[model samples]
Target chain A: MRITIKDIAKRTGVSHSTVSRALGGNTLISEATTDCIRKVAQEMGYQPSAAARSLKTNQTKVIGVIVNSIDDPFFSEILFGIEDAAQQAGYSLFIAASQYDLIREQNIVQTMMEQRTDGVIICSSSFSADKGRQLLANGFPVVVVNYKANENFNYSIYHDDVDGSQQLTRHLLALGHKKIAYLGNSKSGRTSLDRLNGFKKEMRKAGVKINPAYIFEVEGSEPELGKDGLHYFMNLPDRPTAIMCFNDMLAIGFLHACQQACIRVPEDLSVTGFDNITLSAYTSPPLSTLDQPKYSIGNEAAQLLLELLGNKIENSNNTHKEKVLKGSLLVRNSTSAPLQNE
Target chain B: MRITIKDIAKRTGVSHSTVSRALGGNTLISEATTDCIRKVAQEMGYQPSAAARSLKTNQTKVIGVIVNSIDDPFFSEILFGIEDAAQQAGYSLFIAASQYDLIREQNIVQTMMEQRTDGVIICSSSFSADKGRQLLANGFPVVVVNYKANENFNYSIYHDDVDGSQQLTRHLLALGHKKIAYLGNSKSGRTSLDRLNGFKKEMRKAGVKINPAYIFEVEGSEPELGKDGLHYFMNLPDRPTAIMCFNDMLAIGFLHACQQACIRVPEDLSVTGFDNITLSAYTSPPLSTLDQPKYSIGNEAAQLLLELLGNKIENSNNTHKEKVLKGSLLVRNSTSAPLQNE
Candidate 1:
């Protein structure tokens, strides 16, 4: 027969409540009592039941992590961060992939709630402020990653995309490139809009007018879109001298297309990318990209959710704060001065 | 006030147990009664508590998946399959990563047991037959993935690694490669041993003498190990013209080393990898590899566990069995006839 906490309490001549407190390592319990109970529990080989304890405390110590897709390397790094932080806090994680489907996101959220997960950290593409608010209203702590909906919704962690994009554009401008093309995700998302706005702002700051024909948008996160974007720009009557892509995946596709066309990187054209995934370093010519604090963002989000579960923060209204992480530009072999002929 | 089953029963003029059966869509209940109860429950805006129902039935409709590490793309692909299949079966998954630590694996198993998880699917690297026997003794339905302990414990889902490696070696031999080297993982795992046996068997069948100096063992899964393996082999007086890696990651590392050394793939040497990951296709020269059905293996494991949970399978000792999935060789840009000279 399996040993139970009750048996340990009985053996230690302590009340079950006191035994529970001691086993949980509550500071309110006397040190001597804690040691005694712990010793007895160990001797008896008693294992605390997570389900029974959760029923009494209303906290499962389980964090639900929902990602847009698991196949993407960017999100995988973020998940690693979240898992690392969660493990440090004596918590386990339950992961689900939304697969970029809004309905699936909703379903996953509902399932997490049904599981009575103490909190959730979401790296979703289509999650809305309204949904976050609904969860908050239902007493669920949620931390949104990589996207912010509204300032009113609490617990959001994102990179400063606008600033990051602005810096990237300025670097290109400083390199003496005047005709620069932007390849990015569709404007449906706030992230894409922010990046676009930042690129335009940087261009205006440099006293250069934004060229309408130099901007292209892709509908999804795939390298093929990047290839298509490159093909579209290259066919223009006056093609830009350089291209800035939304992410490294797109940049890689662009590079592959250039390779196929016998166009050398940093020679015939210079290209830059965002999100310095590990693969960025291995690509031919090595991609010059933005290094977003992907892992730290995930870690901080998990930390915030842990705080909420611990009741370190009171009330949902006060938790409606945004944490924006900074990004950096990693210059590798991919970018250089534009050709003098171009 | 939140509506409960009692309220629904009262409104429907039926006993609470009958109402529960009807609302649960239990086959024991009449179809007309189920319809009536469901209508009344809907009218009352009654939501069934999954937790409460689970407590009564002892079935959470949740499967626990424990993986050795989530950082590897191989494990990630397997997880995707498990999650997809579980969702389709109206079951939810709770994932835990052990980070390749044995203690963490044990703790995860204990936690899953405490949660009353219907069944478990473990894709672990360090589990022993003793642990498997212990779990079986405790009446837990477990499907081991990627590793098998003993025939005493049932329900294993794994690819034919030995056969897969043999096929890979034969492919290299058919390409007129006389000197073939084996690049494999450390001797700590059965997977590595199986692959080594396959490679040796194929070489012996081809009447080729095995050179001990040509075999290299990587201490870990790090890409740097692959580079080191390549450098070690290249420095030898008699370097093999063809190299067969234990897996795709090692192959990628080897490829990276070749790129750095300015050694052209399939020209200076031919290379092959196992477990054809998505990134394998994007690697320079692409990778010729064995396509393991990682996702399908996970799906089958989950399905087996679910069947065990539903009592659909016989629990008799003799009824337990292992399922082996076949793998195929994916010929890509990485391999060709070896050059006339090194």
Candidate 2:
């Protein structure tokens, strides 16, 4: 089980001392000699002990995941999906949170590089595609989710936010709502913007004007923001009869706010949310939202990274495997026909 | 620099072959000879190369975290805490879900051993203290969280579930409620039993009678189970006026059932929950829960493991370090005095 320097020396016809220096990456040794010695060591199936595994394969077979926060059930659902795929691929996952900080994201990425991670799957609005491109340029494969990466640096996955929102908007419009409102995240990111575009497209097609007075966009990841947003919409003497929210977190908050205000849902005001996170269906009146399969999104991201790590996607005509999975509209009790008075 | 066996051999005044055999733990070598060679090897600052680094150091500085399910936001919140401490300690965390299965936990523990992890922090109900003791016997440090291990083993941390539950129950009792119901997880693990005992103790102190008809204990981790449990309660001719649930997940579910059934929370029947998970506040009526600081529990567990891994907790008068941290009561909107009509 023990491999001696003499073993490599005899195999490569080099002095034992020279083999030792070359294998150690000693600067005094020529690069060609070192590479040759290392390659032979690898070919001879010399398994480094557990502690040395870091140096031997330089392939930890580990995937680094960057998310905004794990406390959000949305990210956890995605992680469950990632775990399924990663477990099947015999890879382990290590996670870090950027908390939407670009510098933190960059630092984590640098650390991942230092640890020689095979690849990373990031769901970040702050992480620039240009940064991803730099990683790709350095022979690292990166997958960005919930946001599209530039085609030049490819491996991106996201929902067709426009389509999902359009479907949701049309659902409300079909029920005879013209003054529909859009409640979005305070810090609007790619998905929020995409969903907004989708909502506008449907509203335009139906000839229903966008009510700027009814729009409520606020900062904060808390569902409480949705409750805070309600004050703006309700204060409008001619408040929109229906509201569409950026995600379920805000929608749940909106519902709580209405409950506090003693306004009945659908009867007094109709509301809809996107990204049917787990707690959505359990909410009172059950939430009407778009079902973005977070699990599938995670699974797909892991699958892509595995393919990239296995060199299956490298040098292919499909330079970057970009995916935008479609989400289905889940209509629940939260939406209904506008009241006659409205 | 190359660390040749000859270097150690010269230092020990032994043949190079003998030094190599001794380092290999060759049974044929005398114990004294092997001990001398090892001590010299240690003193000479012999550093092993990547392939050989594995043989020299058993310390990988990695912490293996065994969780039941990362999909649950509760666990994720705990993980956030663990990550906080682990990152400060310069260790990386890799998590695995046993899905509440004991066999899988053991398998993961074995795998972690093969990987040579410095220590393991487990938060699985299915994992046994006996198993933990076995690992401890083997010189592996194991920190059990949210579950108590026999003092015979040492290194355990838990939330004072009984204390937290008693406080919440007392809050409901002080509000002039005599017929309060308890909804526990179907699994009814040790934590559930402790919480149940606490609820009973508080009720007994208030001189309130127990109603067998109102106790709902069923198995499962689903939040939707709250809705299903509500059906049983509402059907009773003499139903309890208030409900204290196992955790935030089930409490959220119960609140949804009330919303759908046209029973306004706190107005019709007060409700309370354990483990004030993040979404507890977002729920309609905002659950009045026992604020279990999940993050702190995770932090403390990681800190304990770090201490154990650093040999800071070894060879002390206190072989066993058992911690049961205190939790506070959070009065949210979910609970109120029972209605006179009901």
Candidate 3:
């Protein structure tokens, strides 16, 4: 009862090869004839089986993307950019979240391999350089995204976290904030670590001895932890004049705590966040943070993936195995000069 | 150097059928044997090809999900819920964005069909009932989420949006706000219309005449539009004392606009949002909004799809054709009695 290309050829009074070519999007067939064949095929319920075609080409034209959490606004925007680029490049995506679990990450990779996806891009999943090398050795085109650069992997794309955090720290210093605190989230792998290093480097350059008591690393990225950090910091003998958070989400949490504790931002304690998410712009006082090229990172990741798969792009320099994008500073209402008393 | 099941069997010193059963995850093969065979297969770089196996059993063991935007925080939470359930059910996901474009939606559906996905769950894409009917008629299982109920399709799951919005409206009314303007984003198909209608219905029940001037339907769901809406309303001759937004994102935008205008929340422009996204809770004043069961909707959708696909579970009611989850109002710091002024 299944309809086939031959049946369509018989119905259209065309050769089987012509029907096949039209269905396969061959430009050799006239547009009018292709349209007619497509209409007939749709009416007849002829689904061009990817499974059968994949057997011949050994390519699914599908890419797999694994992220820390899809719900995190940061990953979502990157995915947005990735999708836009993937659609144009004629590849569908198999997206999953690892939730920062290594076992789940491995299972997802194995599944993508078994499905024989053309390539994969991992964004913030904790798959190591060694494992990435193994996949590459097994002839898989892989790209590690939003992670520290590992020399073992042939392909990767990440942000300049060190520069970004340093810029944020100096921004606070320029505002005359000497007694600044850091609200950190160490759980998100090396990106946070890099951000912390940048913060420390800028502080050291200004001849400020790093205060161990001022650095607070929390468990999660939500505002609740930030709020909790605020309570702990406020109870200290000498509260910080400003706070630099791991990211905007944590900063927003601290801002929320300020509202609860009757402490005004920038006046009582200036705050700066990393990764200027869309929501960060709408937060009360419109968060001052580091503007990560989230969408571009995703877009370039997909572009790099296609180039790795030997897809020729017009006027693109695909010679580079890895692309490093930079994050800029977005000065908004959340940061300002420290109060005289503070 | 491609290895086959025969090669695997020879190495494992097991019959080809036993190797097949073990690889297939059949219970007939003992766990120890299956583990040994899997370890050997992994060592040999053996990939059980989905294409070859799908030819025997025409299922992909994958689900395709198309949403309006993953960057939208609400959709991400729903997806969070879906991934949790899907992972437990042992099905991987192929997620993409339709971006509310009908052609793209159809193309995605066609792509999913060609890939032989076991089922699809759509979150606010522009796939109409007729197209859904056509897909169902062609024997594809589809679940429509946060969409209106259509009799033509036996599968659908939606939030009780009217009830939820009415609750929000009533909450605003109880807080002593009589003149309230709605900052709505109307482009989002049925969900938006249903929300607007719920707002009106509650006002009508309270014996208040609906003012057409106060109902401002914005373009997109972003905060910028909401901010623009706030500017227009603030400049009005007799601005409403309270504002109800289409969702929390709009409410946050309005909150931002208020901060820029020196308009204090609750004390000046009391505001409310819907769909209690996680970011909403962190916004200044902890936005009062309606809580939609985003995760549950996704979990139930997958559960229903599995049920429809005849995948059995312990103590599940597969007879239910549809599930409608309800949203509840969460009273927070965003709303209060209106200031006694014009």
TM-score of each: 0.90, 0.82, 0.90
Give, for candidate 2 chain A, the lowest lDDT window spanning 10 residues.
A45-54
Which candidate leads in lDDT? 3
Question: Which residue ranges in model 1 land beyond 4 Å of their true spot?
Answer: A1-46, A128-134, B1-19, B26-48, B126-134, B312-318
Count backbone overlaps in model 2: 6
Q: In model 1, how large is the Cα lDDT of residue A289?
A: 89
Q: Per-prediction RMSD in angstroms?
A: 3.4, 11.0, 4.0
User: Which candidate order results from sorting by lDDT in descending order?
Assistant: 3, 1, 2
C-alpha RMSD in Å of predicted model 1 compared with the true structure:
3.4
Candidate 2 per-residue lDDT over residues B1-342, each given as its tens digit: 235678998888999889878877999999999999999987774533322333465565578888877767778878878888987887767677877677656666655654566688888765666666655555567788886444545778889998998999899889888889988885748878888889999888888889988788868657789877899899988988889899889898889889889888898899998888877887888899999888899999899888887774482335778788989999999889888775
B83-194, model 1: which lDDT tens digit per residue? 8789888899888777756677677777776777777787875565565565665566888987756465677888898899999999999999879999888833888888
Better of 1 and 3 by lDDT: 3
Q: What is the DockQ of each candidate?
A: 0.44, 0.29, 0.73
- How well does candidate 2 match the true structure in TM-score terms? 0.82
Poorest stretch of ten by lDDT in candidate 3 chain B: B311-320
Q: What is the TM-score of chain A, computed separately for every candidate? A: 0.90, 0.81, 0.89
Model 1 CAPRI quality: acceptable
Per-residue lDDT of model 3, residues B39-151, tens digit only: 88878888788877886687878888878877788988888777777878888888868777777777787788788887878776455666566566666777888867455
